[model samples]
Target: MEKVLFKIAKQWIAGDTVDDALIAAKSAYSLRRHAIINKLGEYHTSKKQIKVVLEEYQKIVNSFRKWKIRGAISIKPTQIGLSISQKECNRNFEKIIQKARNAHVFVWLDMESSEHTDETIEIYHTFFSKYERLGIALQANLKRTDNDLNDLIGMGAKIRLVKGAYREKANIAFKTKKDVDNNFIKLMKILFKKGNEFAIASHDTKIIQKAQSLSKKYPRKFEFQFLKGIREEFKSDLVKKKFVVSEYIPYGVNWLPYSIRRIKERKRNILLLGSSLIQSHRV
Candidate 1:
């Protein structure tokens, strides 16, 4: 039954087209949640495909102003041919940033696998050198997270910190959940101390508790971010507390891979979707 539901989840993805995402973003923004619109395909194989993806982004960036929408975008480095060449990735990123900034929006560069970490940061910082609107996401589980945070602290980068979803070797990432959470808090403390503007991006209850408790001490400095359609009850409770909150609303045609991954690791996500279905179709 779990397997069955994950299968259906793939279909829930809003597809590749801009209109599809624009509609979803409108609803998300209206709900008092900021959305990080992600157009799906990762690891493009050619420049032609990269250009097509760029055009897709332009479509969304243009619509945000046209429709008077409030949302930003999350980008995967590989989607614009990072693997093919870092230069190619930088070129593509610059194009996205130029277009997004012109529309008064922002772009958050998502950290992919470990292999692309260095080049990704290099490219991201290169952009940050020019555009303050281009932001970056950092993973707390990574061994080098602290160093990265320290080095990039003064840039005023909009960072969304996650415990990291990708499976990695024990040496490169924290093997225990406790370690990850501890590291997350430690990093959060650093960010707070440095007065860096950031989002507490996670759905973990204990971590959220720690954040909320700490946030109470400095209520005006932080915001919590979560994925759209996940952790609704918790988010509601957080909102009631008056802490700024956001939903990472992903749309676009290539969203199927995200669904496939959720199905593949259904243990973490299946319950969130299954609960709603079970409640609706109670026996």
Candidate 2:
């Protein structure tokens, strides 16, 4: 059952190694799409495990450089050791950032759940000036994201706006799809007006249309980002219209947890999986 489920989940994750990821990324690039590659795993307590992940990222950086792939790497704080200590996590992050910088590869800090928000922002700010290409993801569903956007705008930070996937309390996050979508547009406008560069990350046609409308008014450096497999046809149409598009490509051995979290975040994914299973059984 687990193996069958993993097969369904592979639509989201590229594969389980840098080589596999690059192959997937190359395919995307061939279609005139950019990619953001991420290795799956996070919240580690062991220093040895953290070091191992760091090493994997370094390999990713080297591969990007060698292949001349026009993409960046996304990383989770805990994957580098944020659960152990912010200081330790920062140290590990800096090491990867420095290597990426030398290789001219961008490194994006991914925002996890609400608990790590403030610390993630602080760490991003701490290194913003030192690393010019560093970027961070922001969750639009969070109630405080408006203020967070305003604050980070002053720093000229590169931000990726996501609809947010983690489950949070009513007080902390928008509870309804309508509210979340509204907030996503609101935050997108803020970034468009004030940010230096940003990525509008979503698969919703309505939100993308809203962004398209807003872009005409508040012109700035920005692009649209989507998950690798979701809405490929729409993404291609957007690319045809000359809008910059990037795909978030995740790859690693620890795909199960990531896949489970994805399903938990979006109930529709379960229906998709069931449909796929039924079709496969028919086959």
TM per prediction: 0.89, 0.93
Give Cα distance to truth, residue 66, candidate 2, Å: 1.8
Which candidate leads in TM-score?
Answer: 2
lDDT tens string, model 1, 95-143?
A: 8888887888878888887888898889878998788877778888898
Candidate 2 local lDDT, 131-222, one digit each (tens): 98999999988999988988888888999999888889999999888898899888888887788999999877788998888888988878
Model 2 misplaced regions, further than 4 Å: 269-283
What stretches of model 1 exceed 4 Å from their correct place? 1-12, 260-266, 276-283
Residue pair clashes in candidate 2:
none
Residue 192 in candidate 1 has what lDDT? 68
Which candidate should be chosen as best, given lDDT against the real structure? 2
Clashes of each: 4, 0
